[model samples]
Target: MNLIFIDSIWFTFMLLPFLIFIARIADVTLDTLRIVFITKGNKIIAPILGFFQILIWLVAITRIMKDLDNITYYLAYAGGFATGNYIGLILEEKFALGIQMIRIVTQKDASSLISNLYEKGLHSTSVEAKSNQGKVHVIYLIVQRKMIQNIISLTNQYNPNAFYSIEDIRSVDVQSERINTKQKKYRHVGSEK
Candidate 1:
């Protein structure tokens, strides 16, 4: 019985490092999500994610403190954090939980592109501007991040030479009619009450 007890204890010690590694991964992933949500002005969900992140972090830290002599545990914790950051970024991309403003400048006539955007349910404002080259049309569009690809595809189809820039939007006080319609289809991350 004594020998069996000693073996069990040894086994548990051997397993501790992996367990700590997993916990660190979980906490850091939550930390990444929480920070992203905070930046996006998601008041409702950011705090919730932060709470869980800290909780998991505490658990992992406690294990590390208990096993101060184990170099493996330290390595596992650091490795998990690095891996978690990559995983978190991938998850954020998959979620695409925010809005972006896209600016398109093109020398080509923008009427056709604007009409195409409208037809596709994307609202945009076009202004005639003069650049060093010549007269250009600047088109501004605010859209969900998930729809960026669609907008890009449309732009490429309409005017492949159009210069475009995309910026992350923290909050939009007023949304266009088209955005309102699209908002009904997908839940915006921070828009929840």
Candidate 2:
């Protein structure tokens, strides 16, 4: 039984494809994270992730090249790529690595929304502008990416008719007023898993 498992067509077709599939999932997931880090302006982590992504990719591709005629390997590779994209996006969301700027425009009085934000320990800038609608209050908040949904909830609760847009902030002057000075240790997420 040991000999059969060690040297058999079962190992070549089944175990080999499974290995390739797992490897592709890992490498592609790493690639996705690397891209996210790059866009976030993280110079150190991006390159480290990229190195492992390419390394695993080369190993997986070499195995597939050895058995080009095998349909199972192709299926595994394609499936892993697709699944990796989904899993990578989920992981990035979980990591929530970066800052976001949210711009909110409302026709209603923004005092309630501003108060809600302040109560939540979030700082925002509000300006009164004249639009075709006569007057509008524009509020801008810069916060960590993870806090986006909570902020949105506050806006929806206070100003249901508000128009809000979110954008990724590539860089921000940390020394400026209204920016949170507390240091967040993001490395905990990566090391925990």
lDDT values for all models: 0.81, 0.85
Pairs with steric clashes in candidate 1: none
What lDDT, from 0 to 1, does candidate 2 have?
A: 0.85
Candidate 1 worst ten-residue window by lDDT: 184-193
lDDT of 1 by residue, 9-99 (tens): 5544666777888888898899899999999988989999999999989998997897698788888899889989988999999998888
Tens-digit per-residue lDDT, 1-193, candidate 2? 4987856888878998899999999998999999999998999999999999999999999999987998999999999999999999999999888888999999999998787676556788999999898799999988888877877777887778889999999989988868742324222211331
TM-score for all predictions?
A: 0.87, 0.89
Q: State, as a TM-score between 0 and 1, how close model 1 is to the true structure.
A: 0.87
What are the per-model numbers of colliding residue pairs? 0, 0
Candidate that scores best on lDDT: 2
lDDT of 2 at 1: 48
In model 2, the worst 10-residue window by lDDT is 184-193
